[model samples]
Target: MCGMLGGLLLSAVLIEGKIYFSETFGEGWQQRWRLSTWKEGHAEKMGKWQTSAGKWYRDEVEDAGLQTAEIMKFYAISASFEPFSNEGKELIVQYQAKYEKDLACGGGYLKLGPSTEDLSKFGDSTKYNIMFGPDQCNAEKRTHLIFRYGGRNFLKKAELPYKQEGEGLSHLYTLHLKPDNTVRVLVDLDKIYEGSLKDDWEMLPPREIADPKDQKPSDWLDEEMMEDPADVKPPDWVESKMMVDPKAGKPEEWDDEEDGEWDAPKIENPNFKGPWLPRKIPNPDYKGTWKARIVPNPDFSDDPDLYKYSDIGYVGFDVWQVKGGTIFDNIIITDSLKEAEDMAQKWKALREVEDAAKKNEDEAQAKAFEKAKAARAARSKENKAGDTKNEKKDEL
Candidate 1:
């Protein structure tokens, strides 16, 4: 809508988007989510999933999410939903994750795949259609955005940096995949990467390959600048960079054959010029570079529906975590960009409340530390004064 408001023109866009699947984990999350029984016998290595708002939040109910409840374990969990394909429409996959503890290594990502009859069997071996999220282990950190094609997973070539330092704070990870084969990756609503799938991923064969029959000629002069035939090295230029010192004198103890001929220690020659050659000019016979002529790749075949997914009925999380306190919530798969943006408002509000609360807590801790330091200093000063008085009395 466009109108004149107080002599100033204003316009507003009210756009809406469709939601394919959404999970808030508010109530009955256990019924909706299924935990994998991987390593069920190994009690020490198996991790568990719990729901909570963490230690701090503006609204605990709204902030509640599924969190990796233990440290140093492998956690695999998933949920099943009605299967649907993204054929001609745009696709948006977005989620919210927060690390409540220092994340030494882990993944906070999502996987979309086929619907399963048995949810208990979902594990690492299960296949997925799309895998997107933040993965960090020690110093290695990146958001994994991978797509499956031809029964193989192809990771995006573009690396999206993952921040492991923002502990206890929520982050938004969004991937916008358009039917046009372009993708936009965003973190906290800020676009980090935007490019086409055909260029950012090796999902297809090369359009052309080097022809085996084409070869460089035997006399092909490929070098742009070669030693000039007309130009020659200066006659005075010496091949040796060093020579016998002219000022050095051999010892007077003369023994011609017994001690061998006395030779002066070699020193750098000041008059000697280094290796010289003719200055390079443009080559008249350069064929640029002798390259094998490119021919159409026999395996090359274009896929018009490269972005389409036939069936994406299930979404799950399958990863290994050395140290884990990652909470995941507010996952949504939709056909509308505006819907994801609107959902991000919840995370933004949560962040504002968290920042303010953390600031207050830090200030209170600092004040208490300063007061304790002052008391310790005062006690030391009094003890020193008492010691001096006692020493004077002893002297009297």
Candidate 2:
């Protein structure tokens, strides 16, 4: 009986440890993902998702995924799958995004939720278990990491680090949720944030709070310093900050109507001592700042499994962009961090090659543009000289 039980437990562990879903958006990706629509009566505008090398490419066209149409339009899309439970396991979500147009304002993020029935209705009101990615609008550019708690969505209390500007390069964002109720956020495979879920997220009210009935005593001397009674103002101190020059007088030949009325110019008084104040000295009765006593919060409750989500059935992007040319590809969701990291490494290698190709192409284009500009300038100069010579001949 013991041997049979061990075998069954091992099987369950293996099943939970494997990759739940992974998509590179290679050939026939349309079968796996669905594009959402915005409807007005009979008119429906489905979000444009077409394959591209994403502003940079190697010789291989297979290394592309569906990119945003990049126009004055709204977008909402999702790809659903079988419901996967993250309970008692590490949930890893990873993906790559490229802002080819150096997106000035847009959301390049993904949402994971349980519902898949009405992806077209996905909007700001849609609830999600997790929302992670870079978002920028005007001066505010940051990675958004929001989690739903007790039927309400709560954003991370700490500011998520993200780059507002882009260099037309692809970046990978990864989120690792460990079974121990801890989370780690990474950008480009580098860990940017790591902490317990309870500390970083306000999932619950604080365990303790300042006692309401307790207050600082009115007679408590919190000030560290006081004015020195011994210090006094000097006898020669000038009261006025500025004074009229006694040696100067009105011009003798001045006419009131023709010339402006002559007046002695007021200058800063050298003898002036700005305000009179005694020097500060250490206060004898000084007391430290009073802090209210803390007690257990009445409403505080503990939940060790706050990081666990029951079901995550779909991954989607619902974003608005001013000038969208963002490409999202190589999405992976698994229970193993090692699997996610390995996937990121594979994508990183491809990005290096594509980036190099883009650099070379840019240089070649710049040189060609400069050569054309020079030729145009030379022709213009020759025409001007010929016109000048014809003008001189006409004068002759």
Candidate 3:
């Protein structure tokens, strides 16, 4: 499956040439990137952003990517570049993200937008051309792929495939948008969704729709079955669900003033029959569901270049994290899927090594904890014995 998807992606974007922009955070990344200190609701409190080369996996740490402060409230940060257009070429956006603190509620996504005069003022209100990546809060875990169309942002109509179970591991997310108005989403280089933009998003009204002039007749019988006219309820059938118990009687010694008023006990009725429902028979006049005839939608106008973005000058992370420890690295915007895949392959190799080291560290830590617990138990037993001896001496 991986091979097949890789082949398909290669065929799709291999024709496109140069990379528009790329960021690997090699050195002096702080100078290139800008951090946002914006708080929720324009509140006084704000989150601070910091860069890190090490990622925390449980107690183990591996050298990699940028991380937010461990106690972040709400954070936003971005990096800007000169405007570039992907007018008639495939646009590929790929990045690696890891939530090392097992993100319970947060967004580990990035946004692509046109140039803003102030990168420091970037926040939720900033207009973005494309926003894609992982987001999880409460029980909802989704991969958001929102695109700005006309004047509003629109979310993809189809269910986005996202990683919901794992954490502390880096996953590569890649978005491929072609000039033909089609898009594909890949996680770890595996294609999760591939469909046309018009079919997946409400970017435009459908090309055809049910005719407004056509309507179902008032006497149309769409029911598949009807109550049997010949069937009748038996006279002996009882509908009551409960009845007074014949064997139950009030205690003779009961005082009306002190004790509650005597009453017969209620029990399940032995002769109870469920509410009578007439038997159903096939409806001879039944017609299947009525659907109006379709006609070409007058409002729809095709736009073959819907996927093209004229200017995408900045890429940033505008997210709200409950428990922050997400690392963002290796952001690349290119016109080549092959370049993205090559980068992904490098990250995948590094992830495997990191995962193995983390597993070993976790195992060693668990063993050490168990050994310390047993030693503590022994020491506690000796202390208790010494206290008992002192108490005996005092008693004597």
Candidate 4:
């Protein structure tokens, strides 16, 4: 009911400020399923109605709609533990989940591996399997289809058809095992991503091989002997490679007129100025940010009101100062322009999620009231029938 009111197909439930994708679909949308947490006494309560540690969850919210790419996440919960003492040992990770109902309009993928702070360390070198289809897949020449893979790059992995009947789902997913074998990924099927599979999975590459000598093991192993890569440290090159180059764009340029020597020139407009831009409004269920800003009005010669500098003219002041003001908003403050855009997208998504959650709560309350009213009416009818039967029996 919250989903219907909020217009969310697959509404994510935020419990204690944490978001979770509900893995339930079909006619009976009363219950939700998700991974269990590993709290004290959770193992025994996992299968129980209220104490399941890592088993699927049953949410009280009803179906609103299907979720789109606006929701991205990384989560993995497994009861089985594999001890890892091998370094650079190759392993495959796989899991199977059944779709209860056929989704006519939905898209997403699944990935498994180590996790980084912002999905920066994911890669194809790790074994992985993903199946993204429809718009999410972003295939060159296909529509409404699925793409499968075992690597970060789709081009380097396998692709498969993801179409299924009403209750059909895919199986046989595979991912590489890293030295720090702990796995993290966005296993939700109703989300999309723009980056490679590793980014989509939100997994970090292994920091260190469990066994340094096992870094390039002779063979790949199945999931049976897998271990967690929690105690590993990233190799030297990984840290060095991941470092951000401070002088990335300030490369020295050779001036032909200066005898082919390299010299770094200062930027003309180092302090960028721009106007405040507005963002676009997505659907109620949308969960991405949108932003735009008006370009900053520079005190350049172009503005007739401001003192202008001509191409060949110079100011004739002996000891005068020239200064003006510039206004900009939603511009690059610390990160890149693209990162700012991404932040806007995330804000938009958060708004959508909040709106959806509010709507879902309202609908659930209404449904509860309706059910209570119906139950009360049925009880009243039964009471009247019993009164009549008692009177007839007394007369006999």
lDDT against true structure, model 4? 0.27
lDDT tens readout by residue for model 3, 1-396? 346437758765455477777887766788888878555466544556665655443223234577776554677888888888888888899998877676778899999999888888888899999999999887888999999988788899976977634556777888989988889888877778999888889899999999999999999999999999999999999999999999987888988898978888899998998999999999999999999999999999988878877888999988888888787888899887777777776567667766787788789999999999999999999999999999999999
TM-score of each: 0.74, 0.74, 0.77, 0.19
Expressed as tens digits, the lDDT of each residue in 1-396 for candidate 4 is 212212211122222221111122234322322233333343432221121111111222322222211112222221111222223332222222222332223332333222222222222232222222221222322112122222233331233334222132222122222323222111122211113433323233323323323243234332232333343433321212133334645334545666564444443343333332333333334333322333432432221111111111000000000110100011111112122223233223333454465467679999999999999999999999999999999999
Q: How close is candidate 3 to the true structure, as a TM-score?
A: 0.77
Minimal lDDT window, size 10, model 4: 312-321
TM-score of 4: 0.19
Model 1 lDDT per residue over 1-396, tens place: 011110110112225556878888888988888888866677577688988888878888989998888878888888888888888777888888888976777888889887778867677788888899888877889989999989899988867777545668888787877777878787776667878888888899989999989988998998898767888887788878899988889888868789998878999888877777688887888887778989999999988777899787887888778777788988988876566666777778887877787788889999999999999999999999999999999999
Name the weakest run of 10 consecutive residues (lDDT summed) in model 3. Answer: 54-63
Residue 281's C-alpha lDDT in candidate 3? 98
Best-to-worst order by lDDT is 3, 1, 2, 4
lDDT of each: 0.80, 0.78, 0.81, 0.27
- From the highest TM-score down, the ranking of the candidates is 3, 1, 2, 4
Q: Kindly report which residue stretches of model 1 are placed more than 4 angstroms away from their true locations once superposed.
A: 1-18, 40-43, 221-289, 362-396
Tens digits of per-residue lDDT for model 2 on 323-363? 88888888998886556666776567767876687788889
Query: Of the pair 1 and 4, which is ahead by TM-score?
Result: 1
- Considering every candidate listed, which one attains the maximal TM-score? 3
